[model samples]
Target chain A: MKTAKISNPSIVLQLDGLTKKIGGKAIVDGLSFDIAKGEVVGLLGPNGAGKTTTMRMIVGLIGMTSGDVRICGQSVRTNFEQAISHVGGIIENPEFYPYMTGYDNLMQYKRMTAGVTEARIAEVTRLVGMQDALGKRVKAYSLGMRQRLGIAQALLHEPKLLILDEPTNGLDPAGIREMREYLKQIAEAEGIAILVSSHLLSEIELMCSRIVVIQEGKLVTIRSLGESETPTQKLLSISLQVGNAERAQELINLMEDITIARADALTNRITLQLRQDQIPGLVGKLSTAGVEIYRIEEVRETLEEEFMKLTGGNRIA
Target chain B: MRNFTGLLVNEWLKLSKKRSFFVAYAILAVVFGILAYAFYELSPDGLNSTVDFATGTIMLQAAGQLVPVLAVLAAAGSVTQEHRYGTIKFLLIRAQSRNKILASKYIISVVYTLTLVLTAAVLAVVAGYIVYGGGAGESTWSDFLTNIASLAVYSIVFVTMTFMIGILTKSNGASIGVGIFSMMVGSLLVMLLSRYTITKYLLFSNTDLSVYNGEGPPIEGMTMAFSIVILLVYMALFLSVSFAVFKKRDIA
Candidate 1:
């Protein structure tokens, strides 16, 4: 019930040894992370990895069995009002009173909260591009609109930390892109920290600056996205369609700074990972071996493969 | 206390937006109207005890029969629907604590119950006037004042019980089912068990505050003071269980 200590002055949210147990089982165990101002941190985990449970604990929607969640150095266990005062959150899918208009729904939030001005309301509505739809009843709204209105209400108070649980769960490709854009804009314009949870790394890769990977109710890794690597230092994976895959694999295996990642003799296709500078040499070696190279194209390491490496082969839902 | 008024206003707006409340109130209004018309048509001549009929029958039916059902729906729905729709998260994650939020809903449930009771009192007076003219039920005002007062004391206990049921069940259909079932069957069971000494301790037995106003206790040797004390004990039990569970439980 004490305030959690912050290691960095810029940190807006701190979770220290956060845990939740039900029926003598830990749903989220010993989970801890920090989100600093202006950073978009993604909570990445497979299905039932406890992403939703962790978010619920932080926002006080669910009580924690142990440890503390701190916002602006205020403990959620002891000082709930002040601790939650600095947080704006959406748990799971956004829900509202369906019979009320979106505007009235926002007004309901405005009334319960202090220091939320009419101008601030207008700004948040505009921020979400929901100004025109504000007068429409929530029952008449689509899922995407509900998500935006949920964000709109969360932003109305202008908290230092924003937590969104599965923000793009039901959106189409276009709506997902729009949501990602809005999140990026909010983080930059408001200069606040945001924690977004999702099971898909593709969504997180596009939206988050850093990723906190969780597996089986534990932290697997915390990695910064877009780690800066010079073109020479980076390894590129290239799939080569050749006349004989066996000949290409043998030739590529002998080359320096290049390794065969996958070789398929049936399709005569082999994927190789090597430095960008090694591509020309790899091609020359294959050609001299009289292995006809039909096609060679680079392949981005996909979400599945990235997660497989992190989780050691557990499937992400 | 920081935004208690805001919480009240929010809960009121929420209840006001519920279409069922409008449907319930409208149906009550139509039923009241029909009762007035039936009396007007049946008695071309004014009844001798029109004051007794209006307050005792009409007002009692409103407070006793109609108010419990509607008030239970409102009170139970006020708590259960938040859990159903998952808006409870939005309600709890703000600057307001759970205690203040629950207090606001409880207060509104009481306010809503009183409002329904008062509306019935007004409608009863109007119905009596339409049937027998203004001067016929002269004592109707004093009678209704006492009747509504007892009804308030009588129905407030149910409002609290229904609100607590909503918290316990966390489902509209379930809470309303149990609430109305408890009201109807609890009274029936009290009557069936009235000869037993333990019946005096039942909620339904003590809920009728009219015993203090000369209607007499449901059981022998039960005083007005005893009934009041019993009602207080039940209300305290209902409230403490609900508040404790709501404050301590994980919303998930």
Candidate 2:
């Protein structure tokens, strides 16, 4: 039996034309992608763009209206148990027995996963910064803390691929930062593939190595971060605090191959778009013209902007 | 087998956490307690009359039926609760086979029902003896044992039916509502249908335990041994249908 091998890059998950429908409307239409081991791939999309629906189909939670999903070379519909054993996921808000302590919840999950030792449980608990809170009932946990425990449970089996949906939804800035670092540690240290879905493209930019963007139940773009050979248009935003911002705006208008928006006196905000190489030259010219540049910082358009561009800005703003 | 045990433990943990469990048990207990008090008050002559003997046995049988009622409620949440909470995905991704999960749930539910029935039967019997001061009431040990055995079979059948209900209906509210309503109204419906003699086989009419006087013809054509066999067959049918439906239903 010749199976489709996705190369030696340690392919953890692959979805082929996964489609789903509910109530006479298609939710996910022919979605496909590949996630490699030790890589964090962000599933970026709008609220109803079918990212979560795709994840659900891949994990065998929802049946596909058509198409297939494979994890670690095992087809979910054909070899469900074998395929699913390599997958760990927390969809939407992670839930547990509220009456039970976080440790007890993990213990129950540990009982179902094979070859996961108690020591491993302790390790993941510490990794998520929940070791001190492991003995507390989940009912008392903040949403961020519960999300950490959710991640802990997902890692308990040391699965080949981990899928988390909107994990940073309710987290404060510090908690979100901790989750970003902790997820990186898991991917790098354990060599597990991670697929995270989020509306925060800045977070995705800081984490994922590759990303799949979905728009209205269809694939918009699949691009690699910091690498891969796709040369899409480069976008840049500039923030300036200067003398006579109107004069600076006049210079920006005279320049070719750039779109500029000037700030009002009340707001003091300016946004500019130009080719990657042109940004420094424009900044230099503005500095030489005695604009008394309080600050001229170059801003790279985040995954969020790229996504908006790819989908023609039809996403939920 | 390890996975089976794990699923069983999961089901037990989940069932124990439900609020309906405590409420159901409390209601059943109050009903039984009221019956015990009434038996003590009405049989002031200490059940010396044959009429008192018959009524006391009927009440015991009524309590026996609660065994099935509680079993249905207890098993009702097995699948539907997970579906409601959107945790079926978590369970599906576990390292256990779906077949094992369903089987473990069925076994644990039947065990729960049987234990409840045994407790209720023993309590009712002790209460009956205390209130009526029986001389074994013209019944032999073999006859009493046979009745207990028959009730055990009935309990298994009811548990299996409840499991099927959980599988057939994808919502806890629907499954529990139907299971309880069936236990209350099923016999009446069956009797109505029994205008055609073939429908008599469908009714769980073996509940008329008072008719077993240890010397009579065992209630027309009813035999505890035969009832046990028929109930087992019915249970097997319900189980097969439930498994098939669960295997085919979409997880979402």
Q: Is the docking of candidate 1 incorrect, acceptable, medium or high quality?
A: medium
Question: What is the C-alpha lDDT profile of model 1 across B66-93, one tens digit per residue?
Answer: 8767888888888888988889989899
lDDT of 1 at B159: 83
Q: Which residue pairs show backbone clashes in model 1?
A: none
RMSD of 1: 3.0
Segments of candidate 2 deviating more than 4 angstroms = A21-26, A172-174, A226-291, A315-317, B17-60, B128-136, B201-233
Estimate the lDDT of model 2.
0.74
Question: What TM-score does candidate 2 get on C-alpha atoms?
Answer: 0.83
> What would the per-residue lDDT of candidate 2 be over residues B1-252, giving only the tens digit for each residue?
676677788778777655455675666557666766787677554455333443344243556566667777778877777777566767777877677778877877877776776666566555556665664355444555555555666556666776788888777777778777766676677566655555536636554333454443223566656555666677779989988887666664
**Compared with the real two-chain complex, what DockQ does model 2 have?**
0.48
- Against the hidden reference, what TM-scores do the models get? 0.91, 0.83
